[model samples]
Target: MADLVTPAERRRLYTLLSPAYLWLMVAVFLPLSAMLFFSFLTDMPQDAPDWGVTLGNYAEFLSNPTYGTLMAKSLKLAVTVTLFCILIGYPCALVLAKSIKGRAREALFLMVILPFWSNSLVRIFSWAIVLRGNGVLERAINWVLPFDVRLNLMFTTDAVVIGLVHSYLPYVILTSYLALQAVDDDLIDAARSMGASKLTILRRILLPLSLPGLLAGAVLVFVPVVGSFMEPRILGGRMGTYYGTVIEDQFVAVYNWPLGAALSFILLAVVIVILAAASPVLKRAQT
Candidate 1:
């Protein structure tokens, strides 16, 4: 097939792909190269008279325990959020794909996906409104119960988790739903005919079959959550000083561009390693 294309066909193919390839080079490759170049420098060279390339930026991360601790915290948060999303979203997807039919399913799916249409920042801020003390949640709880309630989740880890989950839950549902749609009903019916319990069928058949999609969604959720800054800042307040926030601070507040660039590269390396680790499992699940 590679050799079958004439010169004109190859030219047309390259012509069709050129714009996207060029855009990728400009948008992604160039910025990464610039960041890598800056990461070795002792300081940002724009105004400084004595700027030179050094390994101190990388050394900062290696020598200091604080950054490592914060990075571990970020990883923990990402894992927690990804698990919660999987637990919550996969069920919604199963119900949507296996149980519902026609227009109702379509409507519910649209409702599920409606959040993706809205601004994420706006959504996170709205959660702040709901999670804060004396907000609608407190009022509603107070209304439901006889006791007086004053809820204040503001500036808490729980609040941050909630915000992050709300932002990313739809991704898992979408991916899992797509995977479930490909599952044949006959397989399930056959399992039923063999007197298999519901749990057994789900564990043995559905889970293994859908693992690839679920893992894909989880990776999507995990990668961004690890690098998240906004939700923590708004919802976590004083308690929100995670690795990403520190990276932001290094660049924006501290003006330690070299350190920031080094941290960013380190983060990139972490993500790449994670994806490399996960790829084999995902491929196996697909098979």
Candidate 2:
């Protein structure tokens, strides 16, 4: 009976999976192929057909010192935000993971995630409002603190960093908490019984064990933050422009679709290199 149904069952399973396979090819593969193809093409004006397949776009991006500087600035901001997220979020996650019970923990987690549900544009605007010179925090600070110290929070790189950290903090918290939750309570008790200092236990046991999750969270937050256009657009104001803006201007303002695509793939390449570098570090940490 089993033998008779096995082949039929396998055929049925394959039939069910066929749609998903087709979807993956259509949705993922096709777009990636198009992007790869366009990335090699030269920019064309609206009146012109095309500038033909060439390395000019890539060459321009790489050769220009200004573009390189923008890339470096974006990377620096991302690193700063990622570090801030780790430092602030890890402790919050630990507290949530260790002591908070079921419903309350769920509520707190929901609260943490709630901001992310809002549109990214909306979130940025909200922050912009708050960080404005006469905004709530600024007004409160002025009212409470000493004379004439008006904080110029908006339109600076610091504002962009703060926005990135705020937006992605939940990812770090969730990952770190999940990692912390996986550690055995019995082992922790054993370490305490052996008179291990709290700091020593955390440094030797907890940090090493949680490295995977920390790395995972870092990658999650850092990658998206580095390429993010909206936060920089709103919070960056005049002074703190990132690489995304340059790519955006090429495509939208300059009508250089080919060059925009090329810039995007360049960004993709850089991100891939970063991930490739991290892969070995992640593997080593996990082991």
lDDT of 1: 0.91
lDDT digits (tens) for residues 147-259 of candidate 1: 99877888899999999998899999999988987899999999999999999999999989988889888998999999899988889999888899999998889988889
Q: Which digits, one per residue and each the tens of the lDDT, describe model 2 over residues 1-287?
A: 35646888878888989999999999999998887787777644445675578888889887888888988888888899999999999888877877697999999999889877989888888999989889877988888988766788999888898888999999999899999899887877888999999888789888888889888999999898877888888898897678888888876898777778887888888989999988998999898
Judge candidate 2 at residue 128 and give its lDDT: 92
Candidate achieving the largest TM-score = 1
TM-score of each model, paired residue for residue: 0.95, 0.90
The count of residue-pair clashes in candidate 2 stands at 0
Off by over 4 Å in 1: 1-9
lDDT of each: 0.91, 0.85
